[model samples]
Target chain A: MSNTDLEDDLRGTFDRAAASVPMATDLTGRATTDARRAQRRTWMISAAAAVAVASIAAATFGLSGGRSTPVQLPVAGGNAPASTSAVETEPSVETVSGTWRPVQMAGLKALSAERPEDPVLVFRPDGTWTGSDGCNGLQGTYNIGQRGEFTAKAGMQRLIGCDNVPHTGVLQSAKRIAVDASTLEFYGADGRELARYARAR
Target chain B: MEFEEYVSARGQDLVRLGFTVSGDYQRAEDLAQIALMQAFRSWRKVRKADDPHLYVRRILVNAYLSMTRRRSFTESPSAEIDPPHPVPDPATDIVNSDDLWRALAELSARERVVLVLRYYQDLDDRTIADMLGIKPSSVRSTASRALATLRKARQSHHVS
Candidate 1:
């Protein structure tokens, strides 16, 4: 057969092959799985970022715990022009290394990784910390009391990559945790925490 | 358009083209999935182009080439394939299907891809070159070599 004819036969052969192959249920199973995969990827990327930002703030200023820099942070969708992220930003605390205790957070399943689970929580001596919350990595300010409650204040995260979960919810929850954990009694800003610890250990 | 909708519309055609190019059903599926995900990530930008589908095809060919290079010296899974056109046992119609599958799997990844794009996707050499980010000369040379190889394979199968 001529080459053109051979190409035609090859095409025919492939068509027949596709027809013979057992097809996945297009209505539910295969389609749903792909969607799930997409959502998971999105969530994974976002959570990693949020935790990074929240942790960075905690690491940078919370180590000092003396006083954080008070700066104007740009409010979202507030008729701001140019440099929204830079617009109304809060000031940071002075950099200092202290005996920072690592907050142990459990239940982070490392997806899309072969080995070595990512940091769910990390503590630096300068009283700084960073880690992911399952899906996102956060960076922010943290304050630990000699008593047990802690606060993660002034946090930000970047949302990128493919993940298969609701990003908005994850980010909001992380922020709320930081804001609420402001007391030794484990009470957040509104004073509501089920756990408390001393700063030393 | 929604990602799901786009996938559904182009899914079958993509698989077919992928199979033709990759010369293996399993590898074709992988190419399609990767291409689909990559396209989704940049859908906002790619979907606006004159031919979003072309974007995916380019990614497939480029991706397939990279994959082949990564495993250059290794034996491919399709090494044991039987040519598709001739059924050894017409008594079992399944043999027809198996032969066809074997034929596709036997083609080299490059030849398979060029043929698939040329015949199944109905893309000209220039377009295929653009999609794959290769010089048109390379596409022409590859296509010529692939056509000759495919013809020889088909003839040998027919004689045997």
Candidate 2:
């Protein structure tokens, strides 16, 4: 066949394929929701950066003898006083360095990831984590306190709109974490079980 | 135009373009939504572009390319096209369309992308090259090779 014939065939194929797509349901709403989430995440990251900058400025000012008295900055969560000593004690905990797949979330066996894809979380030993929230990629920093008191700050993420995976929500609210050879579970601030995950083989 | 207005008017077309390029309906929707969401986030700059539609299309295409690259190398194109499509009737135009679809699937991503941008989107070689971040000569060569493969597939289908 001539190139013209091939080109016509190409156009026809695309037109038919495109026609097969049903009208997207509530695309505007979905996009708007995703945009809002992205904006919120961006604001959170900016606020964290600003706080870091302020801490640095405070440290620099104190070192330059600009103040007669030492400044006592509040620790994270602002519930405890900041440590003044240069040395710190290490928390005794096993590393949660592996990939885990959600088995249950918030008392619901059926997960948001069931429709499009399954969510997976990978925690590295270096206090960093990355995974897919079924659709969009997510990355964040995590810290495990002395008694498995877990805190996570979600970092930058792909702004792609997807089904609301409970994994991210569970992680953000997780105050305690437990892990074994085969399973991982997150607990809320009130000690309520939030989610459970199985180590991916 | 306002971002919402733009999405209302051209969203379906963008999704269609995405489907044509990705060959997956759900993924096409996601790509279109993501592109639209991104455009919404920076609607001012997007609206100021020479062609806002093309700008969004570029984002959609780039997302698809990046996604495929991140996928496991063992993945198969046939696996990605998992949704069951209707059997092609020999007497209807869909028979040729189905044959062409399979042929398109057999082509590499870059080759298929070039053909879709060139024939489906009616873009020129230079523009296609610019969007794909390849030399124009490479685009021409890839298109030529892909066309030859499609012709062969068509001839073989006719023979059978």
Candidate 3:
């Protein structure tokens, strides 16, 4: 027989053979659900990995300090001295080293007044930090004293012009740092609150 | 088009194509699902393509080849003979349905794949070559060799 005739015969045979295979009724729904599940699984794995890395860095850099040593702080009205015991009870900078979103800024609000984009600050356990202030990228190294005092020395700042916010000033003037649960507070050298940020989950 | 709409429309055709390629419903479903999931993941890019269906078909073919490669390394040798094909009904227009299917099954995976794409899907040599990542000349030779094998199988069946 000719090749065309043979091909026709094979096509007929293939059709009949394939006809016996039943159609999958809910294949679309199953596939859609499976795809969504796979996407969720991927997101969950990525989030877990981020948390794991943050935790590992926190541990490696001694970001989490034991509460055995309590630091003293003078009271306002010459009353009993306030102790860091209360602050140490919760997760402070030592336990919270990750990306944080600015919730409130005190001194440098004018720069972020027009368009208040949530400024992101990332604290690395290696005494390094990097983030964006809705305008320019900020990168620098930081030092945390035993009393949870944070001192940051600016390293590099991009001079991109943006009308939203300029976080360079706050980040540069930040001297004291405190963490309460998911909230983080940055203080200037004058002991006034510079910026308050919430941990980005 | 939305990914869900695409899946709803072309999903069955893909499953059928998978069935034709694998010759097993379960494996076909797996291959279709895997390809569809991959398509869904890259829907933004895939939907913008000139032919989304063709793009998905390429993914299905790749997935099937990958699955077969993995199966080859993992599956243990079986000494038992394969089950006999069902007896063909004389009333059927196709006289040797069982023998044909059995013959097709006996061919190597690549040979069967080329035959199915050419005859069943009615795809051209260039399209088949593009899908299988082979040259058009290779497709012609493979189809020629596959047809020769089928003819040999038919003759052997007649003698037996």
Q: Residues A1-201, candidate 2: write the lDDT tens digits.
A: 899899898888877787877788777888889988976875465445444433544465457665434333322344432333232233213457788888766534346445455679888764568888777888876667655666666866766666646566667766566666776766554444556777795
Q: How well does each candidate superpose onto the true structure, as a TM-score?
A: 0.50, 0.58, 0.54
lDDT by residue (B55-111, candidate 1, tens digit) is: 777767877876877735453465223444354555343453344445555567676
Writing each residue's lDDT as its tens digit, candidate 1 over A1-201 gives 566666666566556654543332242235446646865754465456455544544454466573254322222333431221222222122211222222321121223333222323433432345555334665543433322223343246555443312223222223222111211111212222212221332
**Clash list (residue pairs), candidate 2:** none
Identify the superior model by lDDT, candidate 1 or candidate 2: 2
**Poorest 10 consecutive residues of model 2 chain A by lDDT?**
A84-93
Q: Which ten residues in a row have the lowest lDDT in candidate 2 chain B?
A: B73-82
C-alpha displacement of A126 in model 1, angstroms?
41
Best by lDDT: 2
Q: List DockQ for all candidates.
A: 0.20, 0.46, 0.28
Model 1 chain A worst lDDT run, 10 consecutive residues: A178-187
Please say which candidate is ahead in TM-score: 2 or 3. 2
Sorted by TM-score, highest first, which candidate order results? 2, 3, 1
Screening candidate 3 with a backbone cut-off below 3 angstroms (N, C-alpha, C), the clashing residue pairs are: A63-A94
Give the per-residue lDDT of model 2 (tens digit) for B69-150. Answer: 7645332342122234466444356677778888888888788888889988899999888787789999999999999999
Q: Which CAPRI tier for candidate 3?
A: acceptable
Give all candidates' CA lDDT scores: 0.49, 0.71, 0.66
Worst lDDT run of 10 residues, candidate 3 chain B, spans B73-82
